[model samples]
Every structure is written in structure tokens, then in C-alpha cells.
Target chain A: MLLQINDVNKQYTNNKVTNTVLDHVSVSVKEGEFISILGPSGCGKSTLLSMVAGLVKPTSGTIMLDGQPIQKPGKDRGMVFQQSALFPWLNVEENVMFPFKKEMNKQEALQKAKHYLQMVQLSNYGKHYPHELSGGMQQRVAIARAFTMDPKVLLMDEPFGALDEQTRTRMHGELERIWLDTKKTVLFVTHSISESIKLSERIIVMGTRPGRIIADIPVTLPRPRRFDAPETIQLEKQINHLLKEEIDKVVKEELSYAENR
Target chain B: MQRIGKQLVFFVGLVIAWELIVRAGGWTPDVMPKPTDVWEAMKRGFSDRTLVYDLQASFTRLFIGLVISLALGTALGILLAKSKTADDTLGALILALQSVPSIVWLPLAIMWFGLNEKAVIFIVVLGGTLVMTINMRMGIKNVPPLYIRAAETMGSKGIDQFIRVILPASVPYAVTGMRLAWAFAWRALMAAEILSTGPGLGYTLKYASDFGDMSLVIAVMILIGVIGSIVDLLLFQRVERNVMKRWGLETN
Candidate 1:
């Protein structure tokens, strides 16, 4: 296994109230595998991804990469947030070249950044600042920046969540093509079941209220899973069946809490 | 271009109004020098090179003073922002000092450096430093936590993160700080020069008043105002607009 998250849990305390965000979630990933943590909001899916990125710490258990314990954030794992999070001060080329500062000289960094920019089909926009680009373009630059470092695991937290439907679908195709080209391990987090189905080789379905993993279903279908395909619909139904109860529980909890107030 | 044209028309209108008022009101040159009289005094001052030397002297002091203030203020600001202990102890002190006018420092400055160029420069530095420090502190404090976390995940930590991510992100605030500092320091420099009898714009204004050269006095005052606004418009505003545009903080 390239990454192992075994019996990991996270809890937060507020005003003497202890809330468990993740409970005994265990996952193992082989190298070059595409996996998605699929859940409704409040399922701690994002938190789990943060932990893997080492931006968050687990309350219990351990996460290891290639048998080394994960500690602080390292260059070995690159992350992409739902927001593009491109540094506004840096243009696209400089943003991608940011990580290469210590490893190489300016010339080498430029060449490498150029390669990644080309990979994302943004060769012409390298001189443009983040604010000048559209939302989707900014996200693409972010993706390219992440890949420039060539991290062992690429963690994306709904990298396409902010885009409109058309852009999101287009990103799905672009991302799938990039994944195939790079063959890098990916751990994606999303609430969109169709997105997960289209992108991941496996989907880890999670439940709310303590945020425990409910199932890890393998996607055995061939490459390029169509959104309207019968098999894709069947899988969506299965996952939705698992998640409907969890989402309903959340709604009922919020409704009763609001009524009490 | 449009803005410049509007400004030109307004300036020409104001000058004409001033010249007409001076003529029609029959105000003596002592009370209000004619615009042409002030212009002649300016030409004479420039031809004699006294104003040129004063200009050089004043700018030199401002340059030196600003360098020291910017360096010290930036360092102090970083210390205050980054360390809880420094902020707790020194934050209130800075706030108090900022409120106390830089002119008030003249007496204490005279005591420290005597009636010398050092005293005027000291006052200028004081005028600039406190505001710059406060602004830099605000800039560092308000950097989006998201940027820091993002950089941290990318393994840019410690000093590297501070310089590359934090510093560049706060540039808009820094530019604003610089503009305010320049305005304050310019005023402080003039006040100090007037009091201490240095070879600067303030000193020339005082000299002209003593000699009853009302035309030259008005000329110096106009020069002061024009030069101050020109720096603000050309240097500070240009830099600020560019930074704000790049940072997407543009107001218009």
C-alpha cells in the first residue's frame, strides 16, 4: 500500500462539548489508484482529506505514506482545495514555479513550470495573473501547480465544486485525461456522487453523525464512465440508498434544533 | 487622459479667479501677491538657484529619513504582529505615539540633536515610522489564513513562507502605508525646517516672510503644495493602483 489511514478519528471541542467528526475510519490505497470519499455535508470527508494532507491531525490512530508516519505537511503530498487558492501576487507561471524555488535555479523552474502549464493547456496564459483568469482557468493553473511538484499523492477537495455544471463536466474529462497521463495516486473528496463515479476507481461512502465509513465500493467499469450509462445509474442508486438516510438524519437534526431555538 | 484634462481646466480656472480677485480687490502685494508677481519671484528664485539648493537639501533629508523610517518601521511592525509579547507590551505605546503629533517631537528632538540637520531628519523619521509600523502590522495580521495554510501544505514554512507568501500578500497595505508616511513626513520636515532654520522649503518661506518678499513667500508655499501633491499623484498613486489591480483590490 502507498498510503494507509488506519482507525483514524478526529474530534473537536467547543464550549465543553466534545464532537466526534470522524470515527475509526480506515483506508488503504495502492499506488496510482484514484479514490474518492463520497458523503453529504457534515460527514467529515473534507477533514479526512485534510488529515491526509497533514493540515489536520487525527485524534486517534495513524496515517502513513509508504510506511512512514504522516506528520506535518510535506512536499510529498500536494493538495488542491475547492477554491483555486492561487496566490494573487504571482502570475500563473510564477505560481507553478513557487515550489521549485529551493530545488532548482530560475531557468530550470521556468522550464518545469512551462511543461506543467502546457499539460493543463494553459501555455498561452502563463504570463497572466490569477485574477485575470476565469474561475475554471484558475483552478486549472492550481492543478498544474500541484502537479509540477510531482507529489506522491494528489489530494483534491472538490476541486470542481465551485464551477458551473458545464465547466465541472468539462473539468471531469480534463482531470481524467491528466490522471491517465500522469498515473499519480489521487484521493479526491466530493459530495457529488456522479462526479465520484466518473472520476474514481473506488468510492468510499461515508455516513454522518460521528462520520463513519459505511462502504468502500470498487468501480469495476471500464475507463470513461458515462453519466447516463445504466451501470453508472445503478451505482449512484446504491450509494444514494446508503446516503439518503444519513442526509435525512442531518435535516431532521437541524429542523428540531431550529424549532427548539 | 480625461482626468488630466479636467484637472487642467480646473487649475487654469482657479488661477484666473485668483489673479482677477487680487486685481479687482485692490489688495496690496503684501496681502496677496498677483499670480504674475509670484511667478516672477519663482523664476528669480530658480535663476538664483537658492530654491534649487533648498529643493535638493529637502529631498535629501526626506530620502534619508524615509529609508531609516521604512526599515525601522517595517521591522517594528513585523515584531509587533508576529509576537504576542511585543504586541501586548508595545502596541498601546505605538497607538499613543501615533496620536501625538510629530511636531510635538521637535522640542524633544532639539534637546537630543540640538538645532541641526539631524534634528529635522529625526522629526521626519518619527513622522513616518509610527504610521508605517502600524500599517505594516495590520497588513501582516490580515493576510488570509487560507494563503498561509495553502503554503504550509506546499512545504513553504518559516522564513521562506513569511517572505514569499506573507510579505507579497500584504503589498497593498504597505503601499497605502508608504503614501500616508510620505504625507506625514513631508509636513513634519517642513515644520522642523521652519523652527530650526535649515536650508529647506520651510526655511526659505520663513526667510521670504522676514524680508517682506510676499511674492516669494507665496511662491514657496505654492511650490510646497504642488510638489507634495505631485509626489502623491505620480509616485504613490501609480504604485498603489498597480498593486491593487494585481491583487484585485481595485476600488474602481
Candidate 2:
């Protein structure tokens, strides 16, 4: 396994009430595999991804990458957030080169930034400020910034959740192309079942209120799956059905807890 | 061109109103000088080189004091932001000092440094440092955590991360603080010079007031206002606009 999350647990305590966010969760990701974690809101899907990215630590388990236990965030794992999160003070090229501090000379960093900007089809926008760009373009710049670091694993948390349906669909296609071209392992978190089914080779469904993986389904759709394809529509419906059942269970449990309180 | 035209019209209207007020109020020449009288005094002061010397003296002290305050205040701000212990120990002291008027320290400064440039510089530093420190601290604190996280994931750590990521990102705040500090320092220096009787525009104005030469005093006041606006518009404002434009932080 390129990455292994073993018996991970996380808890948050406020005053005297202890809320367990993740419980006895384990997952293994193979090299170059695209995996999606699908769940309802507050299901701790983001928490799990954060642990694997080393942004947060699991309370009682080890996350190992390449046989080494992860302790902190490093250059080996790239992360993309729902918001663009580009530094407003920096132009497109400078924002992309922000992570290239190890380079001895600024020229080298600029050259590297140019290369990545080209890869993202933003070469003409090197001097453009973040506010000048559209939402999709800003997110593209963010994606280019993450990939500039050349990390082995890419962790995305609802990276397209903020966009409208039309933009989101277009971004889904763009992301697929990038994934195929890069062949980097990705662990994506989202609430959209169709998004997960559309992007991932394997989908991990999570249940809420002490979140845990309830279903781990492998997808066998052919390469370059079209959004309007009959097979894609059928698979999306199947995933939607499974998600509805999990969501219903979560809602019922939430109502019972509220009544008890 | 249009903006300049508008500004010119406003200025001409202001001068006309002031001239009319002095004429209509029946005020003695000792109390309020006519606009023409003040202009004549300004030309005379300029020709004698007294105005130039006083202006230069004040400008030099203002620049030096502001520079020192900016450097020290930014360092202190960063330290306070990075360490809870520093904030706990120094935060209250900073607030207390800032609340005190800069003029209140003039007598003590004069006593300590004598009636010299050092006294004025002392006042400038005290006035500038408080605002600089507070503004910079807020700026550093306001930096988004996600950007720091992103930098960390890119293998940036320690001082390297601070310089490359934190410092550059906080430029807008620091620049704004510096601008405010300059204004404070300017006003404080004038007040200090007025009391301390230095070779400055403030001293010159005081001398004119003592002689009941209202025209010279009025000229000096106008000169001070013009110089202040010039420094703000030509120097700080230009830099601020350029930086904010490049940073995508400009509202207009």
C-alpha cells in the first residue's frame, strides 16, 4: 500500500461533552489510484482527509505513507481546498511560485512557475491578480499551485463545491483530464454521489454521527466516461440509491439524539 | 485632468471664502490676515530662505523618526503575534503608552534631550510607534490560516516561511500602518517644535505669533498644510496605490 490509515480515531471535547468525529476507521490507498469519500455534511469526511494530509493528527492510530508514519504536512502530499485560497497579494505567477522557496535563485522559481502555469493553460495570466480572474480560473491557479510542488498524493476537499452546476460539470471534465495526465494518487471528499462516481475508481461511503466507512464500492466504468452516457447515468442512479439509504439512517439517528437531549 | 480641474475649483472657492470671511468679520490685521497679506508673507519668507531651512529641518527629522519607528514596531508586532508570552507581558504596556497624548511627553523629552533635534525626534518616535505596532499586529493576525497551511505543505518552515510567506503577505497592513505613523509623527513634531523653540516651521510660526505678525503665522500654517498633503499625496499615497493595485486589494 502506498498509504495506509489504521484504526484511526479522533475526538473533540468542549466543556464536558466529548464528540467523537472519527471512530476506528482504516483505509488503504494504492499507488496512482483515485479514491473518493462520499458522505453527508458533518460526517467527518474532511477530518479523515486532513489526517491523511497530516494537517490534523488521528488520536489513536497511525497513518503511514511508503512505510513511514505521517507526522506533519510535507512536500509529499499536495492539498486543494474548496476555496481557491490563493494569496491575494501575489499575482498568478508569484502565487504559483510561493511554494518554491527551496530554489536558490528567483529566476529558477519563476521558470518553474511558468511551466506549471502553461500546464494549467494560464500562461497569459502570469501578471493578473487573483481578483481579476474568474472563480474557475482562480481555482485553476490553485490547482496549478498544488501540482507545482509535485506531491505523490493529492488530497481535495470539495474542490468544486462552490461553483455553479455548469462550471462544476466543466471542472469535473478538466479534473479528469489532469488526473489521467498526472496519474497521481488522489483522495477526494465530497457530498455529491454523482461527483464521486464520475471521478473515482473506488468510492468510500461514510455514515455520520460518529463517522465511519459504511460502504467501500469499486467502480469499473470504462475510461473517459461521458456525463450523458447511458451507463454513467445508470451508475449514478445506483450510487444515489445507496447514498439515500445512508442519509436516511443518519437523519433518523440525529433526530433521536436531539430528542434525548 | 478632470480630477485636477475639480480640485483646482475647490481650492479657489476655499481661498475666496477665507478672503471674504476675513474682510467681512471686521477683524483687526493682528487677529486674521487677509489672503493677499498671507501670500505676500509667504513669498517674503520663501525669498529669505527661512521657510526652506525650517521645512528641511522638520522633514529630515520626520523621515528619520518614522523609519526607526517602522523598523522597531514591525519587529515588536511580529514578536507579539508569534508568542503568547510576549503579548501577555507587552500588550498592556503598548496600549497604555498609546493612550497617552504625544504632547504630554514634551516637557520630559526636552528635559532629557535639551532644546535640540533629539527632542523633536523623540516625540516623533513615540507618536509613530504606537500606531505602527497596533496596525502591524492586526495585519499579521488577519493573514489566513489556509495560506500558512499551504506553505507548510510545500516544505516551508521557520524563518524561511516567515520571510517568504508571512512578510510579503502582510505588506498591505504594514504600509497602511506606516502611513498612519507618518501622520502622527508629523503632527507630533510640529507640536514639539512649537514648545521647544527649534529651527523648524513650528518655531517660525511661534516667532511670528509673538510679534503679532498674523500674516506670517497664516503663511506658515498654509505651508504646513500644503507640505503635509504633498508628502501624503506624492510619497505615501503613490506607493500605497501601486502596492494595493498590484496586490489586488484596491477597492477603486
Candidate 3:
């Protein structure tokens, strides 16, 4: 396993109430595998990703990357947040070069940034500020930035959730192309079932509120999967059925909790 | 071009209004000099070389005091923001001193530094430091945690993280502090000169006031206001706008 998350748990305390967000979850990822964690909102999918990225500590259990225990955020685990999160002060080139401080000199960093920017088809926008770019472009810049670090794992949390439908679809295609080109391990978290089905080699369906994995479905679809393929459609429907059942359970539980309170 | 035209029209209107008000109020030469009288007085001062000396003195004091305050205040503010011990020990004392008017410290400053350039510079520094410290602390605190984490992930830590990531990111806030500090120092220098009777614009105003030459006083006041506005608009505002534009902080 390139990555191992064993019996991981996380809790948050507000006022006096301790809310358990993740409970005894374990996941293993092979190198260059694309995996998606699918769940309802507030199912702690993003929290799980944060824990894996070492942005937050797991309440119990452990996460290891390449046999080393993860303790803090490192360049080995590059993260792309739901929001663009680009430093407003930095232009596109600078933002892309942000994580390359130790690996490259100024000239080399600039060259690498240009290379990645060209890969993202943003070579002309090297001097453009974040605000000058559209939402999709900004997110692309963010994607370029993460990839430029050459991280062992690429962790994405709803990176395209805010984009429009057309833009999202186009980005999905672009992302798939990038994934094929780079072959970096990706652990993506999303509420969109179709998005997960469309992107990942495996989809882990999670139940809401004290999130637990309800289904781990492997997608055996061929690489460079087409959006309108018959096989893709059949697999998506099967996953959708499982997801609906889990989502119904979540709604019922939420209603009961709200009524009790 | 349209905006500039509107601004020009507004400025001309303001001068016309001022001239009309002076004429309507039946102001004497000693009470409120006419705009023309003040203009003539300014021309005379320019020709005599006294105004140049006074302007140079005031500007030198302002620049020196501003530089010192900016350096010291930024250092102290960062320390306060980062260190609990420093914040707890000095926060209240700094707040108290800031609230007390800069003029109130004049006598003490004079006593400590004597009636020299140091005394005037001391007042300007005291006046400017507090606002700079407060603004800089807020700036540091407001830097996004994600950026800091991002830097750490790239092997940046401690002072390297601060200087490379944190400081450059907080340029807007620091510039704001510098602008505020300039205004405060400018006001304090005028007051310091008035009290200390130093060879500056404020002292020139005071000297004119003592001789009942209200025209010269009015001319000095106009000069001070013009210079202050020019510094803010042309220098500080230009730099701030350029930085913000490069940073994408401005919307349009």
C-alpha cells in the first residue's frame, strides 16, 4: 500500500458536546490509484481527507504514507481545497511555484511554474492575478500548483463543487487527462455520486453523521472512460442505488436527532 | 478623463466657495485673511527662503520619525501577536499610552530629550508607533492559517515562514499601518513644532500668529494641508494601489 489509514477516528468538541465525526475508518490505496470517497454533506469525508493530509490529527488510529506515520502537512501530500485558496498576492506563476522552494532555485522554479502553467493551458496568464481569472481558471491554477509539487498523493475535497455544470464536466475531462499523464495517487472527496463514478477507479460510499463506510465499490471500467459509455452507465446506476439507500438512512437519522433536540 | 474632469470642477468650486465665504464674512486681515492675501503671503515666503528652510526641516523630522516608528512598531507588533507573554505584559500599557493624546507627552518628551531635533522626533515617533503597532498586529493575525500550513508543508518554518510567506502576504495591512502612521506623525510634528518653537512650518505659523500676521499663518496652514494631501494621494496611495493591483486585492 502506498497509503494506509488504519482504524482512524476524529472528534470535535463544541461547548460541552463531543461530536464524533469519523469512526474507526480504515482505507488502503495502491500507488497511482484514483479513489473517491462519496457521501452526503457533513459526512466527515473532507475531515478524513484533512486527517490524511496531516492538516488535522486523528483522534485515534494512524495514517501512514510509504510506511511513515503522517504527523503534519508536507509537500508529499498536496491538497486542493473546494475553494481555489490561491494566495491573492501571488500571480499564477508565483502561486504555481509556491511549493517548490526547497526543490528548485528561483530560475528553475519559474521555469517549472511555466511548464505546469502550460500543462494547464494557462501559459499566457503567468502574470494575471487570482481575481482576474474566472472561477474555473482559478481552480485550474490551483490544480497546476498542487501537481507542480510532484506530491506522492493528491488530495482533493470537492474541488469542482462550486463550478457550473458545463464547466465542471469540462474540468472533469481535463482532470482525467491530467491523472492519466501524471499517474499520481488521488483521494477525492465529493457529495456528487456521478462525479465520483466518473472519476475514480474505486468509490467508497459513506453514510452521514458519524460517517462510516457503507459500500466500497471497485470500478473496473477501462482507462480514459467515456462519459456516455454503456458500461459507465450501468456501473453508475448500480452505485446510485447503493448511495440512495445510504442517503435515506442519513435523512431519517438526522430527522430523529433534530426532533430529539 | 471624466473622473478627472469632475474632480477639477469640484476643486474649482471649492476655491470659489472659500473666496465667497471670506468676502461675505467681512473678515479682517488679522481674523481671516482673503485667499488672495494668503496667496501673496505664500509667494513672499517662497521668495524669502524661510519657508524652504522650514519645509525642509519639517520633512526631515517627519521622514526620520516615520522610519523609526515603522521599524520598531512592526517588530513589537509581531512579537505581541506571536508571544502571549509580550501581549499580556505590554498590551494594556500600549493601549493606555495610545489613548493619551500625543500632545500630552510633549512636556515629558522635551524634559527627556531636551529642546532639540530629538525632542520633536520623539513626539512624532510616539504618535506614530501606537497605530502602526496595532495595525501590524492585526495584519499578522489576519494572515490565513492555510497559507502558513502550506508554507510549512514546503519545509518552511519559523522566521523563514514569517519573512517569506506571512510578511509578503500581509503587505496590504502593513501599508495601511504606514499610511496611518504618516498621518499621525504629520499631525504630531506640527503640534511639537508649535510647542517647541522649532524651525519648522508649525513654528513659522506660531511666529506669524505672535506678530498678528494672520496672512502668513493662513498661508502656512494652506501649505501644510496641500503637502499632507499630496503625500497621501500621490505617494502612499499610488504605492498602495500598485501593490494591491499586483496582489489582486482590488476588484476593478
In order of appearance, the predictions have TM-scores of 0.96, 0.94, 0.94
User: What's the DockQ for every one of the candidates?
Assistant: 0.73, 0.57, 0.46
Q: What is the lDDT of residue A211 in candidate 2?
A: 89
Report the C-alpha lDDT of model 3 over B1-252, residue by residue, as the tens digit.
Answer: 999999999988987888899999999889988888888899999999889999999999999999999998899889888888888888778888989879788888879989889999999999899999988888888888877766665656778788888888878888989998999999999999998966899999999999999999999998999999999999889988887786667776
- List runs of model 2 lying over 4 Å from the truth: A103-111, A253-261, B1-7
lDDT of 1 by residue, B1-252 (tens): 999899899999999999999999999888889999999999999999999999999999999999889888888989999999999889889999999889888998889998899999999999999999999999999998888878988899999999999999888888899999999999999988888865888999998988899999999999999999999999999999999999988866
Off by over 4 Å in 3: A223-230, B20-26
Q: Model 2, residue A38: displacement in angstroms?
A: 1.4
lDDT value, residue B32 of candidate 1? 88
lDDT of each: 0.92, 0.88, 0.88
Model 3 chain A lDDT-worst window of ten: A95-104
lDDT of 2: 0.88
- TM-score for chain A as predicted in candidate 1: 0.97
Clashing pairs in 1: none
Error in Å for residue A237 of model 3? 3.6
For A1-261, candidate 1 gives per-residue lDDT tens digits of 999999999999999999999999999999999999999888999999999999999999999999999999988999999888899999899999988766788999899999999999999999999989989999999999899889999999999999999999899999999999999999999999999999999999999999999999999888788888899999999999999989888999999999999
Candidate 2, residue B132: how far the Cα is off, in Å: 0.5
Cα-based lDDT at residue A93, candidate 1: 97
Task: Please report, as a residue range, the 10-residue window in candidate 1 chain B with the lowest summed lDDT.
Answer: B192-201
- lDDT, candidate 3, residue A175? 94
